[model samples]
Target: MRQYSIADLESRLAPSPRMPVLFVGHGNPMHAISDNAFTREWSRIGADLPEAQAIVVISAHWLTPGSTHITDAPRNRVIYDFGGFPDALSRVPYPSEGDPVVARAIRQQFLDYEAQLDAQWGLDHGTWSVLVHLAPEPTVPVLQISLDYAMPLPELHATFARLRALRDRGVLFIGSGNIVHALGRARWEPHAQAWDWAVEFDRVTGDALRERRVDQLLDPFRTWDTARIAVPTDDHYRPMVAAMSLLDPDEDLSFFNEQIDMGSIGMRSFMTA
Candidate 1:
């Protein structure tokens, strides 16, 4: 990939119109390098997208309290933030540059919300795994916003409301996490049966989104039947809530790769206008 200075990159990105927001159920780390159905769908999603100014990813793996972290280095590294993967997976690199100017813009925009620039945090599997399929060339500048683990659902929703403006500026805000993630239930069984709880939870969640019921969608733990099993931890599902809260009612929504993975986990990938 051709390396560009942060200034050069930001200058090129500033004038474009905002890209759509995506909520991707990025399942396992192995999907990063594998040529599977989900990977093909991700590639198709990228192929269909309009050019973006920059990408702000709210990945499931990086969570913090009150603060959002943005990568500001000129050359960002690929984080092998997973274990027990093949050595070739570790060797895979997506050397996308980071734009400090854009990072600063995000920081200033969320000044009251306490945004911080991190030099050390690189692209985790929640990021590169999906991006490797989304933008295989790795030419687009990328920044990641951390989930405030301590905040309530409403607070996170409000934060996303402030972030809605970035959509018009050509930045693609992506929330990458599974809607039905039960770590204990996920298995490699080729013919595994879909757990009833997982099915019910994913269906209810999808229905709520389709109905534009933001409140119901935000409070999944209360409204959904399988919150405990589906969302074993809030870290993986909160990012989706953050992204969904930013969507406009009039925005066009499309669900791609709408299926269950490992029998019970939803592998749905969706985009909003």
Candidate 2:
């Protein structure tokens, strides 16, 4: 990938046009309430993003084994999917409205997979945790599409690629998950040095993303040796793949929060340029 200066990247983007897709490495739930480097950056990014008609999030936290689902409620309730966190974290309410119309449109695009309109599950920490800082106002309608755990990586990527048309209709698509989320290998301490394998996997993944080599990332579990540790489960890494699938052939990508945290989790994030 060519190294594009900020000016070069900005010049390529259209003036106040379609929304850019975002792949956010939402590392810790605590970042939802804390005033940290990651949260501050999220806020800054949100401020810069153009207004959208609706927001669609593909979150790592929501997984359906056999099918895809999209939230279609009029309003969303925050789900505290993680325990042992502060009470304030659970109390943080996004109060974002749901777009049933947009949800139906998403389902129409995924009809081959028998996509369902879901009203049971609400926004999990993978969403509100980041949006609490990103779109703090919660005025725009928000919807979440679940990951089909049984689907192959390539198939999932192909399926998501079809949704790129939504961007033209003023939908802000966000794929929220960490690149290397090996919780079992994590050192739960501040300033913990990242593991060598974690760093290596992150570097290679970033290289693939920068070069727009989505095939390498689609099967990282077998393609990259370090993925055995860096991607113990596909849950976290799949969202990034879904995000990249939405990239336009002519679109460039810019990365931020390019660091590994807690010895194993990679906080590298990227967006369309």
Candidate 3:
């Protein structure tokens, strides 16, 4: 396979606007409402990033059994997907308008079956929690792309590749989920340190991401036991695969918020232009 540069990737869809692609490792919902380092970084990215016509977030929260769906609400309301959080967290509304044109562009990008435009779906925790920090006002049009868990691996990867061209369409694609999300072993206390296995798993993932050996990520069991402990489910880890697919060989890579929190959640994020 040919390794394309950022320039080459944009040239394919030249004359269209181009923007950076981001994979944000959102650890906890509290990060959204808090004024901490992580949220500060997110807000900084928002201020620094170019004026985006639309933002398409592929969140781990909205999982589909068979096919993918894109949120198409003209004015999307926040849907508090998680429970047990404070009422203020649930009441937080991220009212980012939807773009039908961009949504259509996303659907049309597919070579196979088209992605469906979902009117019912709203901003889930995986998406809004991060976006609220990134785009506080969120006046920019925001569309969400749901994960099709039942889709075959090769096919899902192919879909991610197709989504890369969206950058040139003035759309910033964001993958929202942690690299290591082991809620079962998470500590409730703030400033909790990461476990040894969590550190190892995060390091391995970062290495794979930097080396462009993303396929190795699909099968972690043969590589390290720590990875098995890190990723018991695909929801969190799968977003990274999509992020990897967007990588351009010649583009500069940037990472931020490299801290692992609550013992298991790896708050490691990266980006490429």
> What's each prediction's TM-score?
0.92, 0.93, 0.91
Question: Which of 2 and 3 is ahead in TM-score?
Answer: 2
lDDT (10s digit) by residue, model 3, range 105-149: 677677577688898998888888998888888757888888899
State the number of backbone clashes in model 2.
Answer: 0
Candidate 1: the clashing residue pairs are: 17-170, 18-170
Residue 221's lDDT in candidate 2: 76
Model 1 spans > 4 angstroms off: 1-13
What is the alpha-carbon lDDT for the whole of candidate 1? Answer: 0.81
Question: What's each prediction's clash count?
Answer: 2, 0, 0
Question: What residue runs in model 2 are displaced by over 4 Å at the alpha carbon?
Answer: 1-16
Best by lDDT, which number? 2
As for TM-score, the candidate ahead, 1 or 3, is 1
Q: How far out, in Å, is residue 67 in model 2?
A: 0.2
- Alpha-carbon deviation at 50 in model 2, angstroms: 0.6
How does model 3 fare in lDDT? 0.80
lDDT of 1 by residue, 33-143 (tens): 799899998998888889887888999899877777888877778888878878988998888988777777677657487778887887888888899889888566888
Superposed by TM-score, candidate 3 places the C-alpha of residue 202 at a distance from the truth, in angstroms, of 0.1
